[model samples]
Target: MIDKFVPSVATALAGVKDGATILVGGFGAVGQPDLLIEGLIEQGAGDLTVVANNAGYGRVGLARLLAAGRVRRLVCSYPRIPGSVIFEDLYRAGRLELELVPQGTLAERLRAAGAGIPAFFTPTGAGTRLVDGKETRRIGTRDYVLEHALHGDVALIEAWQADRWGNLTYRGSSRNFNPVMATAAELTIAQVYHAAPLGALDPEAIVTPGIYVDRIVHHPAGALHA
Candidate 1:
């Protein structure tokens, strides 16, 4: 049997060591997996390099992780927003490191890692501080910079439904970044709302196949966060 369901969040997060790169799936709070993040806080792994769309909002989800001082570095498009005080404070004090990548560039990097593409050229950051020490070249009239694929040791994502086999689906806007992060990580952990039996999900509705997932936890939609 290829069952990957775990009884609790702790079991799903097992073996995540210190200094690991974590691919966090979500666009702001929409698809963000807060229960897993809360569990990770208790799991107590530190010095994490998190790849996400933004720093975090308010004091939940990624913000909570940052406040817990578990993150060593953050790689994202937006490191600051209205309610992102924790990231702002830590970054200003120089207690945290930030890698600011453009939104499109960030997504492509994760996608490239999953697709086995070592590196690629993009015109997004040419002739700017974003490409400061990185290689740049001009093809035709537009300039491009060499961007390497971004891979993760672990990925924490939220799925709307799953089976014991770990195949996944997403709900509405929560699907953002989850699918790509699942493919880009060495170990993908999914927090699912529904634990369906085998063959319960419509085959065409499965967004992430079971082969890419390593663990699954059932955390219902109304369980945590706003």
Candidate 2:
């Protein structure tokens, strides 16, 4: 049998090690997997590198994880949005390391990783400080920089629905970074609002197929407001 359901968030995150790279899915808090993050905090694997769209909001989700001192580095596009106090304090005090990537570039990098492409060129940060120490090439008067694919040891996802086979679906913008992060990680753990019967979901509505997801934890309140 190929059942991927896990009983709890802690079980979903089992085997994650210290010094692991975790891909955190969210566009601000929309698709952020807060319950799994809380479980990760309780699981206590430190010295992590977290990749996300932004630092975090208020003192919840990713922000709380950083404050817990589990994260050694953060790779994000927006390190400073409103209520990202925890990341700011840790960064300013040199307790945290940061790698700022352009939002579009970050998404592409993860996509490329999942697609099995080692590297790609894009014009997003071609002539800026973001491209420093990187290779640049000009094609038809437009300059592009080479970006390496980003792979994760684990990806924490938030889904609207999932099946025992691990197929997943998301609602609205909550789908934002979840799919790409799912495909790019070695072990993908999803916190879903519902665990539907194997054939309950419409085929066309399935946004993330079962092959990319490894574990699913049915959390009824996971995305109530997202």
Which lDDT value does model 1 have at 41? 96
lDDT of 2 by residue, 1-226 (tens): 8899987777898999999999999999899999899999999999999999999989999999999999999999999999999998998999999999999999999999999999999999887898899999999989989999999999999999999999999999999999999999999999999879989999999999999999988888724321
Residue pairs in clash, model 1: none
Instruction: Evaluate model 1: give its TM-score.
Output: 0.97
Candidate 2 backbone collisions, by pair? none
Where's the lowest-lDDT run of ten residues in candidate 1?
217-226
Residue 216: error of model 2 in Å? Answer: 0.7
Q: Residue 189 in model 2: shift from native, Å?
A: 0.3
Model 1, span 129-221: residue lDDT tens: 988999999899999999999999999999999999989989899998999999999999999889999999999999999999999988876
Which ranges in model 1 have alpha carbons more than 4 Å from their true place? 224-226
Give the poorly placed runs of model 2, Cα more than 4 Å off: 222-226
